[model samples]
Target: MIATVVGVGLIGGSLAISLKEKGVANWIIGVDHSQENLAKAQELKIIDEGSTLEDALQRSQLIILAIPVDAMLKALPSILDKIQPHHVIMDVGSTKEKLLQLVAGHPKRGRFVAAHPMAGTEYSGPEAAVRNLFVQKTMVLCDVKNSDEDALELIESMVDKLNMRLVYMNAEEHDLHTAYVSHISHITSFALALTVLEKEKEQGRIFELASGGFESTVRLAKSSPDMWVPIFKHNRSNVLDVLDEHIHQLQQMRELLAQEDYDTFYKLIQKSNKIRKILK
Candidate 1:
């Protein structure tokens, strides 16, 4: 089978590599707004070739939309407009609510499947693409009931072949849960990075004094704003809810520290340690 990857960025390039490795697609064609990205993907051997969306759609059996959620919203309907009965389109966008709603009742909705692969790194572009990026990662399929059985089955099979865990959820639940688990992490990281940059005026001191914990906590700050801004915009309500709680928790900690209530501050940290069992 020939597969077309529309973004040719980190997620798309990585998926292209995995598809060929797992024998899901014998040939992979890439389509992207940037000819440079397409060329880079080809040079990296991440794609067999790069083609326009129209040409790629004509020749490919599977289309993977790995672009940002906003781009997905604009491109999806047109892609669906051109899909043949044999074609199945899947998206790996972070937020789902808006995109799902946009195509909810379209005539060719059944040909498209809504998916969010819960995997990535604090990186982008074809050079950041790595092999086995999706292995053992969760792939959330939203609103599967709206998709045709064949389309859903094909994606499920591909996910299985990719060695990923499959999860099912509605659009609302997907967006809300991801806000708590995924979106909040990036926002916090970005904020923490900004805080450090602002407080530590001596720039070189940051590099000299940064520890493993600090590095890990701020790593997501390196993520592309182009990718994250759309996610935050689409999942605005859920993100705001999580941010409210996060700010409340921070306020409690600040109050405890300011009041010199060491006992209570220690207890707060101990309570937070409950996450150890869940994570480990």
Candidate 2:
């Protein structure tokens, strides 16, 4: 397959590498607004060539948009406007609802497939790309019924080549669930990192005493705001709902601690530990 990945950042670069390594794409043409990123991707052999969006679209059969959610909303319609019936367009953005709605009524809607690969690291750019990043990960296809059967099957086959598990969901359900599982975690991590930074200003010994648990909990805070801010913006209401409940839980724990209610706090901790059953 001739593939073109727009953005050439972490997700796009990683996809380019995996597709080449697994023989999924015979050639990869990269498209990015950043010249430096395009250069880096080419230097790393992540993409065979770099071209403008219009030129790349004309040359490729499979077109993947791995840009931020906001950019995807703007670019999807235009790309769909230009694609021929034989071209298949797919997006690997974090959120789905808005992008799906933006192109819902386009005449070429069936040529597009909405996908979210539930895999990534707290990193960005071409240098952060890695091979086999999608292996054993879940690829959620939202609103598949809106896509042509051949388009859907092409993506499913690509997902299978990447060794990922496939699941389906409507855009609304995917947005709500991801807000709870994915979005909230990043917000909590950012908050935790800020809290620790505030303490570090008063005491330089803060990070010196940090441990793995602290590192792991705050790791998502290192993620790029350029990528996450748009996500929070697009999924505003859902994120706000989750944040409210999170704050309430923290308030409950604080009140328990203030009152010296060790018994109830112990039960709360025990109850939270039940997450192991679901995660494991």
Candidate 3:
């Protein structure tokens, strides 16, 4: 298959590499708003060539949009408008509810598959693209019932060939769950990074003592605002809901610490350790 990967950044470039290496695509065409990204992707051999979306769509059998949610919202309908019956379009946006709703009633809706590959890192650009990023990661397919059978099957087979795990959910469910599992983590990391930076001004050696735990906790803060702001905007309600619960937990812990309630604080830490069972 010839695949056109729109956005040509970390996710798109990485997927393009994997597709060719794993034999999912015979040729990959990269489409990006930034010509510099296209040039870099070509130099890295992440894409076979770079072209405008319109021209690439004409020759590609599969189209994968790995752009931010905001751009995906703007582009999906038009791409669907131009899609041929043989074309299958998939999106790897973080939040799904709004994007899925926008295209819900489109005449060519069946040609698109809503997907979020639960993978990435605190990086961006074509240079950050790495092969096998999706390997063993979860690929969530949202609202598959609305997609044409062949379209859904094509994405499923591609996910399998990439050695990813498959998950199914409706749009709303996907957004809500991801807000809890993914969005909240980034927001917390951003907040923690701010907290430390603010403190570092007063204590210049603050970061000198930073360790693995602190590094891992604040790593997502380095993620691109270009990508996450739109996610928080689109998944606002779900993110706010999770933030409320997260704040409540933080308050409970704070109250315990302030009152010197070591017993309850101990219990709170013990309770939080339950996450290790699930994660490990």
Specify the highest-lDDT model's number. 1
- Per-prediction count of colliding residue pairs? 0, 0, 0
Runs in model 2 deviating more than 4 A are 202-204
Candidate 3 local distance difference test against the native: 0.94
Count of backbone collisions in candidate 2: 0
Measured by TM-score, how close is model 2 to the native structure? 0.98
Weakest ten-residue segment in model 1 by summed lDDT:
271-280
For residues 1-280, what per-residue lDDT tens digits would candidate 3 score against the true structure?
8999999898998999999999999999999999999999999999999999889988999999999999999999999998899999999999998898899999999999999999999999999999999999999999999999999999999999999999999999999999989999999999999998886685547567878998899999999999999999999999999999999999999999999999999999999999998893
lDDT of 3 at 193: 91
- Model 3, residue 224: distance off in Å is 0.7
- Give me the runs in candidate 3 sitting further than 4 Å from their true place: 202-204
Look at candidate 1 and tell me the lDDT of residue 279: 86
Using TM-score as the measure, name the better of candidate 1 and candidate 2. Answer: 1
User: How do all models score by TM-score?
Assistant: 0.99, 0.98, 0.98
lDDT of 2 at 109: 99
Better of 1 and 3 by TM-score: 1
lDDT of 2 by residue, 1-280 (tens): 8999998998999999999988889999999999999999999999999999889888899999999999899899988989999999999998999998888899999999999999999999999999989999999999999999999999999999999999999999999999999999999999999998886685557557778998899999999999999999999999999999999999999999999999999999999999999993
Error of 2 at 209 (Å): 1.4
Q: What's the residue-level lDDT of 173 in candidate 1?
A: 98
